[model samples]
Target: MQLDRIDYALLDALRKNARLPNKTLAEKVGVAPSTALERVRRLRESGMIQGYHAEIDPQALGIGLQAMISVRLERHARTDVAAFDTYLKTLPEVLSFWHVAGGNDFLVHVAVRDSQRLRDFALDAFTTRKEVAHIETNLIFSFQRNARLPAPPRD
Candidate 1:
């Protein structure tokens, strides 16, 4: 589905604050509340709009330290990979992980209480795993997010 200026406006506005009221969203996008609601529903049905979520601060939740881990798996076999992927979900400290291209198999983002726990986690989690070949860790002293998408391509 082709998105017009109004659709782009709605997307930008909603991503900035998903909790925008129908009336407010309509005004911001220069449309009637009903139209805005209908457009949003269509966006969801078309898979343009995925889902809405609140942005929670890790620090506010008492997670003080954050790190990014580059993981190289020893084996690329499906079973080995599946087992490793399954094991990752069981780690509470892991925030997110992505299977990517390049020198590493996966990039994992984790948040913990401090450096000591991070070291322990690295050893107990990846270092001890047989399928894990190597790990490169980077400490994150700060983090930021801008969920806003760039302007849509001009067609």
Candidate 2:
């Protein structure tokens, strides 16, 4: 969907804080509250804005360990790939999963309370899969930066 300056401004305000009130958004974008609402609705309809979620601190939640696992599958059959993807979704410790092109077919992000739990998850859960040929696990030390793109230039 094509977005004009007002639409872009509304998106920028929402990205900064999705909880911003419609009145505040309208004022910031120099539009009526109803117009801001309409643009936001259109953005949602077009799938440009997926959903809002709160960012939680894993350490505070007692999930101190963060691990990224690169999984290489034995076969690239469609059924086998689907099964593995479905299986990963059912795992509570798995935070995110990605299918990428490289030596590995999948990259899995996991968080656990400690090192032992992380090891158990890697061995008992991941390695046991018949479709999984090899696994490489790496510990994440810290997150440097996680930022969204800058807002489009206002005309």
Candidate 3:
């Protein structure tokens, strides 16, 4: 869908606070409340806006440790990759996973309660996978930008 300045303004307002009332959004974007509501609906329908979620502090939630794991698979065959991807989805501690272009086949974001739990995850879970050949783990010290919207693509 082609987005004009109004649509971009609407998106920016929603990104700041998804729970903002339609009236407030309209005021911020200088549009009618109904227009703001309809624009949001269209954005959602077009898959531009995926979903809204409440951000929670992991430390407060008892998940104090975060790690970025680079996983190298023994074999990069299609079936093997699919099986590994499916297996990753089954692990709750595996918060997010990405398929990358370089040496590592997958990059995974994992969070756990503490250091011990993190170690257990690496040894007991990650290492034991049949298709996993090598793994490198990095402990996250502090996050600079935790979450931010992706910038619109360049023309």
Q: Which stretches of candidate 2 lie over 4 Å from their true place?
A: 150-155
Q: Which pairs clash (backbone N, Cα, C closer than 3 Å) in model 3?
A: none
Model 2 per-residue lDDT tens digits across residues 1-155: 77787777787788778889999999999999999898899999999889987878989999999989999999999999999999999999999999888899999999999999988999999789999999999999986533454667555
TM-score of each: 0.93, 0.89, 0.92
**Candidate 2 has what TM-score?**
0.89
**Clashes per prediction?**
0, 0, 0
CA lDDT scores, all candidates in order: 0.93, 0.89, 0.89
lDDT per residue (tens digit) for residues 85-118 in model 3: 9989999899889988789999999999999999
Cα lDDT tens digits, model 1, 1-155, are 99999999999999999999999999998999999999999999999999998787888988899999999999888888889889999999999999887999999999999899999999999999999999999999778788788979888
Question: Candidate 1 — which residues are off by over 4 angstroms?
Answer: none
How much does candidate 1 score in TM-score?
A: 0.93
Task: Name the better of 1 and 3 by TM-score.
Answer: 1
Query: Over the full model, what C-alpha lDDT does candidate 1 score relative to the true structure?
Result: 0.93
